[model samples]
Target: MRDLAELDDRVTHCAACPRLVEWRERVAVEKRAAFRDETYWGRPVPGFGPPDAAIAIVGLAPAAHGANRTGRMFTGDRSGDVLYQALHDVGLASQPRSLRIGDGLSLRGTRITAPVRCAPPANKPTPGERDTCRPWLARELLLLRSTVRVVLVLGGFGWQAVLPVLGAAAWRVPSPRPKFGHAARATLPATDGGPDLHLLGCYHVSQQNTFTGRLTPAMLREVLEEAKHLAALA
Candidate 1:
């Protein structure tokens, strides 16, 4: 929901969390020589999708082999394969194949962002890291002007990080609580509108989650359907 200029700036020189910066730098240096000439953004990578999207998809963070390598959120990762397909199936995206930067695909009515803009060491960011990244997200969301009708938090961590921004903070609790599932739906009052912008939850489409049968194409489609159903009124 961030303006393109603000989003672009964040992607260019973000330094909200120290741990992420260190890890991303390490990957940029220690990984294959193929990435040597490819300079790492070494900062918070902004969400990749439409600028005025109505559906906002939130991921945990960038991935070592994924966004860190390709400079685009969810790119070059197995997780993106399933997610992109689900988007296509739900009419939010063009048919998606690969996660490469050259994929030339874009979400039609959806935008994607992360709780932690930078890739964490093992994709697990500490609480402080998540907290530190919230302001920028707040700026983006507040600036979005309620155009976003549904926010899909891709996992438990993602859900927690998002609720506070939506002012569900008083009711939502901390970790080891709710598990991300196919039916997860949190209807939140819209920040601008007095009505709502539903927030659907899901197990991350990571290799671990998908391979473990925790998430599937059919399951993801159902959640997207919920968004579509809710957005139809708006």
Candidate 2:
């Protein structure tokens, strides 16, 4: 189950990072007519799913025209359409469509979060911004510390943000540590409990990926199947 109140609290006044604060506020101002009467949270959006979930999907951050507008992760956007379809195929979601936060959809045994909570300009967050936003992820991880069996990183930055937090091993020149890619998996180096945090890397289902035909529903399902198996084992 999820605590709606807590989720609201986490994003209520999130200003741990300044650049994001300025950017979010600017969007709220420039795009007011669309969301004029609405009170845009324009802050750090928290993870969405069951609080006790063992499976988590981490994305880069909210898109100015996507989650940042809809006030829900993966809602009101084309990117979400692709992702939710895959979740439905993998049996993690009961609904095939994610129209909005109140569309009567639910994530079973899974949760979704972002490294940089607020939406950044051009959808690119600076390293300093990402680091400053780490505390939010850390707080969410601690809350989910009890049962995080698997992590699915949507892109390279998502992987980079999560790996260090999970304490995966590091190597010099040779770099024995694996790189992020479709189907890549690495066990945490003893930081997040002994259970292997099956890390599955996949290309983010962005407009570029989907329109370019780089990612198909079938390809997404294959990786999701691996995630399901790992979640079950964990």
Candidate 3:
């Protein structure tokens, strides 16, 4: 089986979606005004965390100027500010901020990944793009399954994306499907002798949610605390 580092390296070189490849590369060249002088990663963003992590975080996709710019998940962005801070408060993160790659920030017993590796225009990936990216996420989880006991999904998009992957990974998802809501919890039965998995839902820390008070720092921290507790049991 490939290690997390190996999977990450492979994910970085992927150009499966022509539209995503063109868009990511174009953004890298055109550049954002503030980061024009800096180089953009301009490629797929791989999952970030240790291989033995007990908890997994699933997000929608990389922000166009965030992970796509820093070459690290949730780094160099406002959403990251909210997320890393909450993780730190819950004792999952080594630091409260994720500035860029090589920022010395680290996670303990937790891994962060996304359904879509590349940043899509308008922060929204089409259904086809998302479907095309499924294998990467599936492969990532297969490698992490032995250690990952809990999953924290951010936003409805992430919730939807992860459910199917969980089934494919042999976790018995309910037929009706668990609804996606802040603090929603679903426990998937183990199949083929795999470990039982806990799934937790939280609102995405996007600017729209944060700025409008839909998802506050306190709210996020609370959910992380719960996830940590659940992970401990696993």
Best by TM-score: 3
Q: Over the stretch 1-234, how does candidate 2's per-residue lDDT look in tens digits? A: 244357557564778777888998778667646557665656666678888888889989988767776677877678988999999988999998786667799999888888888999899999998888776676676667677778888989998887656552321112465698977877654443355456789998889988988988888888888888888932
Candidate 1 has its poorest 10 consecutive residues by lDDT at 168-177
Report the backbone clash tally of model 1. 0
Per-candidate local distance difference test: 0.73, 0.77, 0.91
Extract clashing residue pairs from model 1: none
Model 1 bad stretches (over 4 Å): 32-41, 168-180, 191-194
Q: After superposition, how far is residue 216 of candidate 1 from its true place, in Å?
A: 1.2
In terms of lDDT, model 1 sits at 0.73
- The per-prediction CA RMSD against the true structure, in angstroms, equals 3.5, 3.7, 1.2
Q: Runs in model 2 with CA error above 4 Å?
A: 1-8, 32-39, 168-175, 189-194
lDDT of 3 by residue, 92-150 (tens): 99999999888898999999999999999899999999999999999988898888889
Give lDDT tens digits, candidate 1, residues 1-234: 337666657554877677788898888777756566665545567777766767778889888867877777877678988888888888877766545555678777777788788889878999999988887666666655446677788887887788777664213233444445567766654444444666678788888889988787898888888877776722
Q: What is the TM-score of each candidate against the true structure?
A: 0.86, 0.87, 0.97
